[model samples]
Target: MADEDLDIRMFVDGKGPPDIDPYFTEIEGAEAIAQSVALRCYTPKGYAPGHNIDAPNDGVFLPDFVQSTMTPHSLFTAKTLVHGEARKVDGVDSARVSVTGDQAAQRMTISVEGEGVDGEFEFSLTVDPSGLGVTST
Candidate 1:
């Protein structure tokens, strides 16, 4: 059996008014799990009300962390945050996260590989100071 979720867009370009739709798109299986992992990891700690409160610093602090420094420690921290969040998802059996940064472009890429009920899955997201962009699953 596969999980299903509403296909809501998390990151917006902000070029114009937000896209309004009365109907919701549905996503299923590995894609749904992957999207959940991405959203959880992308959200900053303490931002999500009543979620993961025990682990206060669970979410990625990419915007502030990457903007300030690109040190090895920071990259490791990002990886840990992402990995921890990915592992917490219900369908995930195992998860590995990698965070790489480009100092010149001030961009960071977070990649996740895992095994789930639907089988193996991979997800990646590119984030810059502007915001999160270019997600693949």
Candidate 2:
């Protein structure tokens, strides 16, 4: 897919205003999961292969450490709604947040389904702190 299409968005202030319902029905659980995902961001852990790099600074390269959905091994833990979608009354959307220190970018994916109050929504956020840096190799 194109680069733009691969991007995701996440809400910063945790859950929004009063009317906005968060995808994570349980506030406490959602917060915990979100925090866990945040931890996965670009950490100074792991190794870089093939090159003469001194050591494993901090990078989860393409193939080995790649992760899309919230996998079992993910450092984060979340309590999602029974049916996936957050409650409607809150007016918030579903979301996932991830942090990649190597990329230096925070990503969030929000799915808003309706026009107004009756809309269905969801989101995923990823925080990539790595930015556009290349490993020394």
Root-mean-square deviation (CA) per prediction:
4.0, 17.1
Cα lDDT tens digits for candidate 1, 13-71: 31111132234445556656666666665576755412555556456556665588688
Mark the regions of model 1 whose C-alpha exceeds 4 Å error after superposition.
2-23, 47-57
Q: Tens-digit lDDT track for model 2 on 1-137? A: 22322212232354211122344333322332232222222222352222335444333322122234434343222223211222222333444322222212232222212222323323343222222111110
With a 3 Å backbone cut-off (N, CA, C), the pairs that clash in candidate 1 are none
Query: Highest TM-score among the candidates is held by which one?
Result: 1
Q: Which residue ranges in model 2 land beyond 4 Å of their true spot?
A: 1-27, 47-123, 126-137
Quantify all predictions' global Cα lDDT against the true fold: 0.66, 0.27
- Looking at model 1, residue 133 earns an lDDT score of 51
Candidate that would win on lDDT? 1
lDDT, residue 122, candidate 2:
31
> Ten consecutive residues with minimal summed lDDT in candidate 2?
128-137
